[model samples]
Target: MTPVVSLRGVRVAHQGRTVVHAVDLDIQRGSWFGLVGANGSGKTSLLKALAGRLPFSGGACLIGGEDMIADRAGRAEQFGFAPPADRLPDSLRASEMLAFVGGHLDRVRRNLGPLRQALGVDPLLDQWIGNCSAGMKQRLAIAAAFAGGQKLVILDEPFNWLDPVAIFDLRLALRQMVDDGLTLITALHDLHALVVACDDGLILANGKKRIDLSHGMLRDAAVAPSLFEKEMIDILRAGAAE
Candidate 1:
């Protein structure tokens, strides 16, 4: 089967400075892919470019066989993205914010019922986003991202600020969604969770792809989390030195 998403020679720049450099990637349909990188490693930039929130150059970004870079608006409708919680509108209630970001209030509402319950954001819907705790805001943002009923969803550090139980619940929910044919991609800092939850992953260092972790690699990583983490650190260090 054709990959659900593909990137060829992809590059991203900010204010005339190159960030992501000549990256190529493919994400299979219904797979959970993880992006792992340290600070200023271009993970966010790549994710933003893929989500059509940032302009990129020098490549083709295809979603479901269509070039999304050439027709961002049309292809972007097929995916939903949740940036860091700080990007969320604090002035609105959680419900209003969801509707704004998710589009089609009725559809958002319809899809949010189960999502809100799964993410434990039901009680927070009426609360002002400004007043919600970081964890609460995170739950709301996640719920909003999923409420759009998109085939693909991209999340940035989604497990941040979530409690253990909440993290567990979200992981289970994501696994179920992927099994049900949703393609999930996330930028993650939690190495253990990345090893456990992701079917495949890419590691970046200084805006360059340092390592591509396959399914077998992730399975091995799951068995030796510390070893995997150390190896990743070594790879990142090598990249940084170069």
Candidate 2:
């Protein structure tokens, strides 16, 4: 089977400075892939490149056996994005935003399923977008991304501001997608959460790609609170020691 997503010699830059090196990644269909790194470590940049949200240098990004940049709409129809750079229109209700995205996406609406039963908008679906909490809005964002018709989803720091139970719910939700043959690439801060939610993860450091850990690796790493805290602290200490 053809890879769902592929990048070859992909490099990204901002204001004429390189942020990502010559990186190549192949994400198989129906797998959950995590993108993890420190702030400004180019996780977001790589996601933007993968999602076709930004331009980069020297690479071919493919979606389901086709070139992404060459067949823009076809590739676009295969993916959805949460927190998609543009902010929500403040005057719209949660439902209204959903309708708008469904309409704007052209051919993607046919793939959407029903919204979550306990949507973050449950208490405020009737309220304006401006009034919701960050967590609530983030949920709505994921809801919009998974709008269902697409086969792939790209989420950047989606767990921000969510409570513990909400985190678990999100994890289950992503797993459901994988079970149903959907592909995912999420950017996350909490290494533990990424280790928990993703079946495989891509670790980016120093504008380079490191280990691409599988689910078994995540399970064996003791990716609980203490190990996570220690790793982060070590990153800090190593920076200081340098």
lDDT of each: 0.85, 0.71
lDDT of predicted model 1? 0.85
Native-to-model Cα distance after best TM-score fit, residue 230 in candidate 1, in Å: 1.3
Model 1 worst lDDT window (10 residues): 109-118
Top candidate on TM-score is 1
Give the per-residue lDDT digits (tens) of candidate 1, residues 1-242: 79999989889999999999988888999999999988889999999888888888768898889887766566567778885787678899987887777676677866654465678766887899999888988888788778788889999899999899989888988888888888999999889989989999899988899878999999998889999999998887888787
Query: How do the predictions measure up, each by TM-score?
Result: 0.94, 0.84
* Candidate 1 RMSD computed on C-alpha atoms after optimal superposition onto the true structure: 1.6
Model 1, C-alpha of 159: deviation from truth (Å): 0.7
Model 2, residue pairs in steric clash: 111-148, 111-149, 112-149
Error of model 1, residue 158, in angstroms: 0.2
Off by over 4 Å in 1: 103-106, 112-114
Tens digits of per-residue lDDT for model 2, 1-242 = 67778877788888898888887787889988888777777889888767667677656777777766544455556778886423767788877787676664333233443236434444655768788777778777877886645678898988786788887766776787687888888988777777667777777776677556677777766546577547654663453343
